[model samples]
Target: MHRTLLWLLATAALAGSAGPPARTAMPAPPPAVGEAARTGGRPWPVPGTPVVVRTWNPPATPYGPGHRGVDLAAPPGTEIRAVAAGRVTFAGPVAGTGVLTITLDGSGSPPLRTTYEPVRALVRVGERVAAGQLVATVETEEAAPAHCKEEGCLHWGLKRGEVYLNPLALVRGGHARLLPVWGV
Candidate 1:
């Protein structure tokens, strides 16, 4: 499902830059400092570089367990946009990836810190997310994670009711941006 989302998003982006319709609700309050990794820096996510996928669905290994995320070959420090509008539930450090995990503030946090930023939740558990909004910063790391295929890329993922979902389709507010939360 996440792979499909990523493809759909890439197609939409190639076809046109106009993203999906904005969700109803005023803009969220400004995020805290350092909450969002800026567009440019040491570890950029993909600010301008074309979006590329490294592992659509990689096999599981020592890093945690099953494949629960998609790795994008983006330049490190790339600005990772939010797939949907939901408060950030967790953001910090994952063991393997050794980066930050910015999970949305959804139903609940399911201890899935497979990367370096094992379990980093930037936004609070009860905040609001805006489509295409800046959710997490491109990893700010001196050295890219071993799991990262590109020299400076990130393994983005999403979830729906505990189900691991794709991260791309939701990029730049693709179909994944239409998700409804809090009865909104």
Candidate 2:
């Protein structure tokens, strides 16, 4: 009877000593990209509102032929600014053309990356740039192949992972909203 009593006490003590059950820690989700856009208003990369020489034309397939980005008509030597705050991931020449890419901060997993080409980079790679901050200047005709032929243009691109997205959507306040219709 004493042994049974002692075993019961020991079991009770062990159970009482043990604290609440352990919980597995879950990683916090990343901030939404739209929230970042709201905090950082959409700003034109070029001075004023430059004409869009070519609009974004997404391809049917990843390897399909299509314009991956938009071409903004800006003369050579024209200053180019960042459309959003991000860290410069690439700032150098690619395919004989000066290219600059910025990976947006707090834009979720595999963050959105913005690309600008045919521009002489004023900011180097790994640099943190604010929205509307000057990052480069339009590359001269002699420096690289003009995307818009004789007239120079800055090709702006946005990508999340390998999928290309419309950069103008950023400028146009992202997704379109629907209006309520009244019954007549």
Candidate 3:
């Protein structure tokens, strides 16, 4: 009983050092449907089918512990497309997860880049792909057991320089709705 009490105290001390988790009241509304096209943006990286996002939390700082991108709910082997016309800059594994990066043309002063991860890349580095073109496929348990078997989702990310942007902002057509998480 004494040892257990000590362990609980130590755990509480470590938890206190970690501080409270960051929370946002809620994000502002997203653009209406077709608003992106009206604004001259390209279609979603994965189109046609409705995208179900499992997670959409970006880190407040570089290398922070928060989720750096949105995880889209997709089955294994689903085709992953390019969100915009760009050249494939990377198509390889990074720290175990398969990552694909595309540098957008005429996107901004510093240029925008998009990244998809835990995918079985089909395109080669330096390959110029058009908007909505297939670049990779979601990984299956046979391909990436760690991520695919755990949860079949595509982690879609966007960045300009070192600043991460919300990838969903590029595709969300309606207002943002916060999904509640209930615990037992």
The estimated TM-scores of all candidates read 0.46, 0.71, 0.65
Q: Report the C-alpha lDDT of model 1 over 111-182, residue by residue, as the tens digit.
A: 222121222234444466554555454554444546553355566555554555434433334233445589
Give the 10-residue window scoring lowest on summed lDDT in candidate 3: 17-26
Candidate 2: segments with Cα more than 4 A from true spot: 1-40, 143-147, 174-184
What are the candidates' C-alpha RMSDs?
Answer: 11.9, 21.4, 14.4
Among the numbered candidates, top lDDT falls to 2
Q: Go through the candidates in order and give each one's C-alpha lDDT.
A: 0.42, 0.71, 0.64
lDDT for each residue of candidate 2 in 1-184, tens digit (9 for 90 to 100): 4433443343233322222222222122113334435655567777764677776666779999777877787788989888888999999988788999999887656677899988999998899998878899998876544457677778889887897876765554422333578994
Q: Report the number of backbone clashes for model 1.
A: 37
How many steric clashes between backbone atoms does each model show? 37, 0, 0
Query: TM-score: which is higher, 1 or 2?
Result: 2
| Candidate with better lDDT, 1 vs 3 | 3
- Any idea what lDDT model 3 has? 0.64
Question: How displaced is residue 97 in candidate 2, in Å?
Answer: 0.5
Instruction: Provide the lDDT at 16 for model 1.
Output: 34
